[model samples]
Target chain A: MSPRQKRQLSLEVNGEPYELLVEPHWLLVDVLRDQLHLTGTKIGCGIGVCGACTVLVDGQAVSSCLALAVDAHGKAVTTIEGLAREGRLHPIQQAFIACGGFQCGFCTPGMIMGAKELLDRNPAPTEEEIRAGLSGNLCRCTGYVKIIESVQVAVRLLQEEMAGEAGAPVSPGPGRHAAVGSGQGGAR
Target chain B: MALWPFDYLEPTSPEECFALMAEHGSEAKLLAGGTALMQFLKQGLARPRALINLKRLPGLGGIEVGPEGALRLGALATHRRIEDAPLVRERWPMLAEMLQLVASPRIRNMATIGGNLCHGDANEDPPPLLLALDASVRVISRVGERLLPVDGLFTDFYETALKPGELLAEVRVPPLPPRSGAVYLKFAPKSRQDFATVGAAAFVRLADAGRCVELRLGLAGVAPTPVRARKVEAALQGQLLSEPLVREAAALVEDEIDPVGDIRGSAGYKREMAKLFLRRAVAEALRRAGAAGPGPT
Candidate 1:
């Protein structure tokens, strides 16, 4: 087959702007991992079925494996590496770590990214909604029991944090797990 | 494996899209949302010389009410949007419900209704419901435009009636008449995200005193294309809504469907479930219609 022409793509990943030339066949996951060296995003199935390569395109979760890099032009792309704040882990990430959401850790990044989208949209999603939200992300390790709990914990952490920032009273609700601190080093 | 290399074209308008299609002819494929097209590209099932991404095209990504009070869904509207659209949820709950049941939430976020129909995948959930609702698609080319019923849209597996350069612009679903109800039911033996073993959609219009005025039933995953169970409809229409009548009518679906054995189920099992689901869908539709209040005088 003849060589494919490369297209220049300009995208906002996390808060950083990236301008790169990529082949039309280069998937977003490849560009993120191979070219940019942001390897937090994992690829399980090259097809869209597996959510291991889930990323946020303009705040909506999408499978990077199925998306061409050229399609990310002028769009804000958020991978697993972008989830944390200046130095603190995102509440979803903290919740996963605290709740034992992963075993092999292969699907953690994608699961956390999917959870981020879920919490961003529905701060306090029901268990059924959480399952529906994370249905795309397969967890061969945890059997998804702890992953579901992690989302619930994340919801409480986020709600408490939001309430704290607003100077509102934080009454401890029943069955609310204590907030987990970010023990890991500053965001990668 | 990496996708086969291909040139990507971003068209800002329908005319430009048509121009690209005209130039590339059968060598180009339109990309909307890329949920289906991307899979085909990566699996080497489709290696188009050019991919025309429709995201840049304006005026093709909204849900609105047309002049006749019909729901007009722009071709590029995502499945998630349809599932969450307030107008869709309130007016056509069945459509919204079915949309929610299509793949996972993330896939729904990226899959477009237009691409779903054009892909012509027989196992999808939307086509059967659309067919039962008498939905039609608006297709346009450089030459002219035409409206084709959803029933005739799918010619065969992965094949649509759209000719070269013809693009599906919008899907129009007529507003349900008074005392009418529609329901979509799918039997997935595997995970919830898996495609249905036998999917059934039924729309029933009831007159005064609970008499069936009109009925339509559409089945999926049991045929080469989404099929309307005309025999079932004929049996149920004009009959008094009753349990026995619905059961008898739904049994006709077994004869109308041509199911293929697959991992989901054997052909015989699917055919049996098709009849059962059809019965349940028709009965549920009647119940919903009765609860919807009395028909027009």
Candidate 2:
């Protein structure tokens, strides 16, 4: 039996569907970390200012701490844990490690998620654009130099991955690598 | 950091939402994009009994231009959506550019422009710009709908002119004035996402050999509500514009604002910044207006 004032939440997280009976006030971060055991999403500052609890809801990066569990209903949610597929790390995650994006690692997940959103929209973002895209997420360590570098590395990695795969829908079209970090890619 | 338990209700239609608003009265909070409200809830600042989610309602998420060329932003349209709308970029490029810097990309992806105005913070960027643009919000209730000018929307700190049951349904921005140039200046000493230490927006329309046909100014971070810098505007209107002339008029901005000392800056510093920024905003606006020499009809 559902507890009093608890609502059932149905959402897809990390390619897995979850049906949760959550208190109406329960935040999406709490549910993902507690009930669903997806603790990769961290909570740095409880307020929305910190992107520590960032998650992609419907492919848009949003603060999970600020989102009600019920708001995730019928939406596809992606957390930090979702970046790896079939034991292969996503390009962003790989770039973060390769470039030393984080020292404490608390902000890495949110940073990667924010970068994912940025690269998805604009595969090759300028340094300024990359900074603007992930401005919402903050890192108290390393002064953001390596963090920015990580995103740039991710951009090159993603371009190489897409270029290697032919017939992939939405590949940044021909001569995309020429533009590099200065302009738009091929498709989307 | 726990939020108070509440009923989360999604109404499929405006009528149902209105009824829920009426039934719950003060206890029901409308959720558009809950960027600010969620902050309030998690902080124990708000304890509403129910949250009426407005996402299911149709026609409230579109950004369209009417035959008159006015831009209509649906209440549920997120800031990111409005910023990305090709029509907004084509018509109101300055506004599109401004939206790119509101909070951050993630926050913009979730915060509705309607909700941003409704949150009624005096230090926000959009209010001053909206005031300069002569925007109006359409408030809908079960009884009827009415348009309220942006100037008259914010009544007090952390408050708006909206009544308990009235929902702000849309923001209507008139087409950019003919041959007009606009600029929004913000003084955020801290991060780019922080509230403006002081901000100003101006619109200048040049007519007949660079004489100022019309000039308007709006300011924030210096008052309980976004202000129309009338004294400054009055000083410059119909005058042949010059740097000294603009500077002299902008000095009157000190009288237009009542800034409170906060983390942003002291009241005295804000007043001086207000004058400085107002002068810069007007000058930049004039430069832009002059560049559009032939003037668009």
TM-score of 1: 0.94
User: What is the Cα-based TM-score of model 2?
Assistant: 0.93
Distance (Å) between predicted and true CA of A97, model 1?
A: 0.8
Q: Across residues B90-135, which tens digit of lDDT does each residue of candidate 1 receive?
A: 9988999999888877799899999999999999999999999999
| After superposition, candidate 1 runs with Cα above 4 Å error | A168-178, A181-188, B291-297
- The CAPRI category of model 2 is medium
Best by DockQ: 1
Q: Cα deviation in Å at residue A30, candidate 2? A: 0.6
Chain A (alone) TM-scores for all candidate structures: 0.89, 0.86
The lowest-lDDT stretch of 10 consecutive residues in candidate 2 chain B is B288-297
The superposed Cα distance between candidate 1 and the true structure at residue B117, in angstroms, equals 0.4
Residue B49's lDDT within candidate 2 is 85
Candidate 2 residue B47 C-alpha distance from true site, Å: 1.5
DockQ, model 1, C-alpha based: 0.70
